[model samples]
Target: MYIVGLSCYFHDASACVIRDGDIIAAAQEERFSRIKHDPKFPEKALTYCLQESKITLKEVDQIVFYDRLDQKRYRILDTYTSFAPLGKTMLWNAIRKWCGPSNPENDLYHSINTLSKKDGKIFYPHEIEFVDHHFSHAASAFFPSPYMESAILTIDGVGEYATTSYGQGKDNHVTLERQINFPNSLGLLYSAFTAYLGFRVNSGEYKVMGLAPYGSPTFQDRITEHIISWNPDGTYRLNSEYFNFFATEQITSSKFHKLFGGPPRKRESKITPKECDIAASIQAVTEEAILRLATYVREATNQKNLCLAGGVALNCVANSKLLRKKTFDHIWVQPAAGDAGGALGAALGFYYHYQKNERKISMNPYDSMKGCALGPSFSNEEIEIFLRKQGYPFERLSDRELFSKVSDLLVHEKVIGWFSGRMEFGPRALGHRSIIADPRSKKMQSLLNLKIKYRESFRPFAPSVLAERAGDYFELRTDSPYMLFVAQVASKHRIPVTEEAQKAQGIDAVKLQRSTIPAVTHVDYSARIQTVHKDTNSRYYHLIKTFEEKTDCAVLINTSFNVRGEPIVCTIQDAYRCFMRTEMDVFVLENYLLRKENQPVLFEDET
Candidate 1:
């Protein structure tokens, strides 16, 4: 039986198809729409899933949505009523958008109906299941994980009425035991600080995490004292006086700005020491809270393994801190831990819970995520045809030749756009859709940021290290295939900085080389790692291994293959456009390679 899962009408809208409990395909709407964080119904993504799985919409046995519209509507009405008068305008806007004739439920049904029509035949779904938002998250984390049973934790911005939830998953069953409701969310709290620090809310939270290590936690005390009320049971409530999330579109209130010593920083404004300190303070607080929560989850569930899903689960720094504490013997985080993974969870939840299927775990590859390489892929013939049609210069090479050529380019400090196999399913690029470079270069970090990415100079890149050699370069305890865990550079690979460099604060500190792989190392001597496993992605593993053979270093700088303000490249055309737009030296589409010098000038450049 085929099951179709969908999450839409919120950021990172996505779709997935599963056959007999195995994921066939998954992708985000932003990838095909070419719009960052597209929230509309994922028609294109759903279509791609159907095509990739060689099935039509009629073949799908069940269609499950990530959240129940009734629950979300109730939550919205309740919150707006509670904050009445203060949120009158916002409440009206919400009511008009969600409760009007064209509500989410209606739109969703219409979209499904429209997409199902083919050759004058119409077939509606046999069953439509709407799950609790956080339950979807928990199922996504636990069902795809390698554990037979595990404690589950899901934390994110408001999902219906829930903001945070914890439960246990055993076999094919999951039970959410307790939850922290909306209006007091850690995700929203972090997003408020993200906005205050001059970044987009949901998308820019990681930017805040990247900036934290530049400064001391000078404002940590103030934040803990005035913004959040702590509890002994590992739950906390946000102080409403400093937040405007309940009543207005704005995340922070005037009182919050007053406490922070200023108004929100304008986008693209210069980074000040204050912003850096605020980032550090909030990061510290978040890590502490997460550690406490993990402790509580462990004690309550008494489970040896833990599965995590939610936007906050993407914070590598906090994840690393939790790993160090070892509150659980093992932890498995969904690659697409945010709402995108909700689609996958919705399908799996219904399949296991309603259908009563027995659970099966894949031990050889650690988990059933298949390295999160579940997106669309292209053949060499298709790539060649496009290249020829576009009149772009290119050359085809064998696997050995390609790996050797790419490795040599990296050693020579040439940045290469690597596109191979399926695109990654999550926000992370992994290796399939990555911009790869030599991690050893001291100037590479600044070069890639300013010249290639065209973004903040201090944002650190992650390293794709051979799984076996991961411990040789970084102090990691387990595999981090999705680049979701930050670990320190091994002591042997770390270099001492000058006292003057040590004294420098904020962005200036980025100039210091802290490790042998300086380009991927952050100011705190940490690196977000993606351990390349040969079984899951032999080609990527071989590329890194070949580089290691030549340079005696097993790590390669791996970052999403798009510049600032764009989703990662999806199609070959998207890859080509980004290659021409950026200063990357080489572009690899499958076995074909195109050098920057050989390519024609961009269309804009021609005009």
Candidate 2:
């Protein structure tokens, strides 16, 4: 049976298709729409999934939406009614307008209905089902995890009425034991702090994480004393009065500013030591909360393994802390742990819960995701056809030759746009769609960000190392196939470059250095690593291996294949458009390669 899952309305709108228990294709709508964090109906993504699976609406046995609209409506009503004496009619009306029939959720139903109407002659009605948002998040993490039975935890911004949930999954059955409702959300608490720190709430949380390491935790006691009452049992209640997410137009009210002793900082403004310290303090609190929650889940469920999902699960730093705590013997976090993964989870939940399918655990960590390469892919023939139609110069090489050439280019310090196999399903580029540079080149990080990425200079690039050699370069022992862990660079390899040398040199000088690759290395001398195993992604492994053979370094710089503020490339056109717009030296789409000089100037002006 075919199951189509969808998550929309909220940010990171996406679609996932599954045949039986195996995922066929999954992608975020932002990639195709060229909008960052697009919260639309994901029509392009759904269309791509259907095309990639060679199926139609008639073939799909079930359509599962990630959340129940009625459940969400209930929460809105309940909250508003509770505050009726305080007068919240305006907020209620605004919410009603937002959830009108023309909104994203209604549009999704309309699209499916339209498609089903055309296929009505062949299929039956009432095929669509709505899964609980938190349940979908739980399933997305637990179902694909390499565990027969595991404790499940899902935490995110308010979903329906739940903000956090704890459950246990054994075989095909999942039992939700407890849930923390809205107005008492850890996610919202963090988002409030994120806003107060002068960052975009949902999107800029990572910046806070990155900045945390730079300061001391001076405000930990203050936060625990005034803002939240964290419990030792891993459950906590927000003070609520200082937060305005529920009642006010802003995330933080004037009372919050008074409690915190200042107004929210302005974005792109100078970062003060106080801001850094606050970031550190909040991050520490968040990590402690996750650890406590994991411990409670483990004790309550008596499960040795754990599965994690939700927007908060995307915090790699918190994940590292959880791993270090060893609360659960093994932990598997969904790659797309945010709302996008909700789509995949919805499908899996529908299969196991509604369809009564038995859950199967494939314990091989290498096979947990089929490399998460479940997005669009173009064959060499298709790429060649596109290049010819665009009148671009290109070459088609055999697998061996292609690897050798790309390896040679990397050794020469030429940044290459590598688009091969299917696109990755999550927010990361796991070799399929990536910008590859020589990790040894100290200037590579700056060059790519300034010329190609056009983003902040402080952001660090990641390293894609051969799986077997990952330990040799990074102080990490576990497999990081998804680039989810930040591991320190081995001390023996971190030679300090002088301030003068750092200031005077460019890519050329950095390339000749026998010391630190300062560009990719963070201030902590660590890199977020993606380990590539030949069995998981043979082509990508071979390409890295080829580079290794030439430079004797088993690692290469790998960043998402997109410019700043854009989603990673999903289609051939997306890749080509990105390649043409950037200052990248080469474009390697499948087995075909194109040079910058031979391509048309796709961007009107090179800003």
Candidate 3:
């Protein structure tokens, strides 16, 4: 039997298809539409899923949507009705978005009719099912994890009535034991601070995480007292008077602005030390809550293993903290822990719970994500065809030759856009679609952010270390295949801070060399790490191995290959366009290489 799982009309809309409980294909719509965080019906993603799987809608046995629209609609209506004219705009917006003509109900049927018309037949009307939002998040984390049973926690902005849920999964079943409802969300609480700090909500939370290490946690007390009141039982309540999200579309209220003693920071404004301290304070408090919640989940479930999902699970700092507590013997997180992974979870949930498929666990390194490389991949022929059509200069070399050449360029400090294999499904680039650089270069962190990424300078880069050698550079032993956990730089490799570096504040500290691999190390000496196994990505492993042979360092900077305000490149065309626009020195699509100097001038020389 075949199952098509989908999540849409939410940020990062996506779709996935599974055959006999194995994922066949999965992709986000924004990658195809070129609209960052596209929240429309995932028709394009669904089309890609069908095409990638070499199947059609008629062949699918079930179409399970990630969330129950009607139940969510009821929650929105109930909340707005309680607030009345105070929530008029929010109410109207929710009504139009969910109850409008292009709503999920209509869109689902329209997709079937439009896409399945060729056969004069379609999937049965009963094939579709809409799951609860939090349930989907829980299922996404627990079902695909390599555990016979585990404690599950899912936290994000409100999902219907639930914002945070704690549960347990054993075999094919997941039981949500407790939940915290809307207007009292940890996700929204953090987002409120995100907006107050001049960053976009949802997308900019990671930016806050990156900035936290730059400042001291001076406002942790004020945030705890005024913004969110903590309960002892792994739950909390938001001070709605200080948060406007319940009645207004805005993330923060006037009270929130006054509490912080300023208006929200404007975008493109220079980030001050105050913003850094605020980021640090909130991160500190948030980590505490996450630890308390994880402890509570473990105590309540009596499970030895734990799984995490939802937007909060994407906070790598909190993840690192939770890992330190050792509340559970093993912890596994859904790499795409946000709404994108919801699509994959919804499908898995339907397969196990609804269809009663046998549960399977692939332990040691865990679960069925296949390193989250479950997206489209083009053959050498397809890549070459695109390159020739675009009139871009290129080279075709053998795998060994390509690795040798790219490794040599890295030794000389050239930023190379490495695009190979299938695109990664999760938010992380892994090694398949990444911008690789020599981690030994102290100046590379600033250069890549300002020149190539065109984003905030405070942001830190992650390291993709050779799996066997990860222990040498980072204080870690387990495989971090997904780049989900932040580990401290191994003490042996850390550089002592200078008096000048210690006195530096704000962005100046970025100039300080914190470790041997300073480009990938944060100010606090932490690195979000991805361990590249030779078993999974041999090509990426070989490239890093070649570089290691040349420089005696196995770690390299591996960041998503895109600029600010852009999704990670999904096609060779997207890769080329990004390469031409950025200050990237080299571009590698599959085994082909293209240098910026030899390419046609994309713009008139400003000099």
Candidate 4:
């Protein structure tokens, strides 16, 4: 049976199509639309999945949406109405979103109609079923995970009435034992701090996590005392007194504003020591909460393995702490752990659990995310067609020749936009859609951030190392193919601290060379790692291996293929556009390699 799953009208709207018991294709709308977090109906993503699956909409046997609209409406309306006259604007906005043009149902129907008409075909499924939002997240965690039985945890901003849900999964079935409802969300608490720190709410949480190591957690006591109360069983409650999200649509409360100082930091303003301290405090708090939660799950399930999902699972720093705590014998986090993966989870849940189909364990040790390379891919012919149509100059070479050439460019500290195979479904760019540079270059990180990424200079890049050599460079001993774990650079590669540098504070600490692989190492000598296994992506592995052979360094700086505010490039045109826009030195598309000098000049995007 074929199942089509969708999550839309929220951040990272996405679609996934599964055939029988395997994921055929998946992608997020932001990728195709060139938006950072597209909240549209995901028509383009759905169409792409269907095309990748070689099926039409009519051929899809089951349609499963990621959330129950009615349940969500109930909780949303209830929360807004309780705030009453004070929430007048917020209540009206919520009502308008549900009942007016913002209604997902309307966009979905229109998208389906438009797609069908554009294709000169019309069809509809028998019925569209909506699963609980948190269930979709939980299913995304446990179903494709490399565990027959495990403890499951899902935490996000809000999904209907559930903000955090935890339980256990056994075989093909999973159950939630308990849940912490909205207004008590760990995700929101983090996001509120994110906003207060002058970062975008959902999108800027990672920025907060990244900035934490720069300062001391001095504000931890004040935050814990005034903002939240916590229990040992992974349960947490935001005092609600310090948050006005439900009533004002502004995440922080008046008390929250005063506690953290009068006014929130304005976006794009200078990052202050106070902001860094706040980030550190919240990050420490988050790690404590997740660790407590993980400990609780381990005790409750008595299970050796654990599966984690939801947006909060995106916190690599916290994830690293949890992994180090050894609460479980094994942990498998859904690579696309946020709402994007909910599309895949909803389909998988309906197929194996609801359909009564037999479950099959993956032969691969890491489970069935397919390297998270489940998006659209174009053949060399198509790539050549695009180049030709655009009057672009390119040279085609054999894989061996191209690898050697690109490795040479990387060795010379040239930033290369590497586009190969299928696009990744999640926020990460795993080799297939990555901008790579020599990690050994001391100035490469700053160069790439300013010249190519056009974003914050404080953001550190990740290292894509050969799987066999990962432990040789990073403290991590396990597979982190998804770039989801932040592990310290192995001590052997760390640079000795100087007396002057030892006193370096804030981003100055970031400026110090903490490791031999300076470009990929963070201020604390931590590196978000993606270990490349030959079996999953042989070409990328071979390229890195070739680079290693030449330089005796297995690590290379890997960042997503797009600039600061854009999604990863999904199409050949998208790749070309980004390459032309950035100050990248080279572009690699499959076996073809093209230099920027050889291409036609285009208007540079300095934004």
User: Where does candidate 1 clash, by residue pair?
Assistant: none
Q: After superposition, how far is residue 329 of candidate 3 from its true place, in Å?
A: 1.2
Off by over 4 Å in 2: 82-100, 103-105, 121-126, 259-261, 363-367, 496-515, 603-607
lDDT of 4 by residue, 1-607 (tens): 9999999888999999999879899999999898888988898899999998998877778789999877887887788768766688777777777776668776676677677676565545337778988889999999898888889999899999999999888887878889999878999899889998889987988999889988899999998898878887778888878888877877787788888787899899888778878899999999999998888888888999889999999998898889998988888899999999999999999988788787888887888889999999889999888788777889999998998999899988899999999999888999999999999999998999999999888888999999999989999957899989999999999988899878987776777887889999988888899999998888899999999989999988999999989999998888888999899999999988999999877755421
Q: Backbone collision count in every prediction? A: 0, 0, 0, 0
Q: Candidate 4 — number of clashing residue pairs?
A: 0
On residues 83-163, what C-alpha lDDT tens digit does candidate 3 reach at each position? 677878777676786765677777777776677787566655565788988888999998878887889999998787899
Give me the overall lDDT of model 4: 0.88
**lDDT value, candidate 3, whole model:** 0.88
Instruction: Kindly indicate the candidate among 2 and 3 with the higher TM-score.
Output: 3
Q: Give the TM-score of candidate 2.
A: 0.92
Indicate the TM-score of model 3: 0.97
- What does candidate 1's lDDT look like per residue over 1-607, in tens digits? 8999999898999999999999999999999999999989999999999999999888888899999888888888888778877888888787788755578887887788888877344544335788999999999999999999999999999899999999999999999999999888999999999999989987999999999999889999999999997898899989999988888888889999999888999999999888999999999999988888899999999999999999999888898899889999998999899999999999999898778898788765679898899999999999998998888999999999999999999999999999999999989999998999999998899999999999999899999999999999999998999998999999999999988779988899999989889999999999999999999988999999999999999999999999999999999988989999999999999999999999998895331
Judging by lDDT, tell me the better candidate of 1 and 4: 1
- Where is model 3 more than 4 Å wrong at Cα? 98-100, 123-125, 603-607
CA RMSD (A), model 3: 2.2
List clashing residue pairs in candidate 4.
none
Model 2 Cα lDDT, one tens digit per residue, 243-302: 767855588878879877799999878777778788889999898888888888888999
Error of model 4, residue 125, in angstroms: 8.5
* TM-scores, all models, native as reference: 0.98, 0.92, 0.97, 0.97
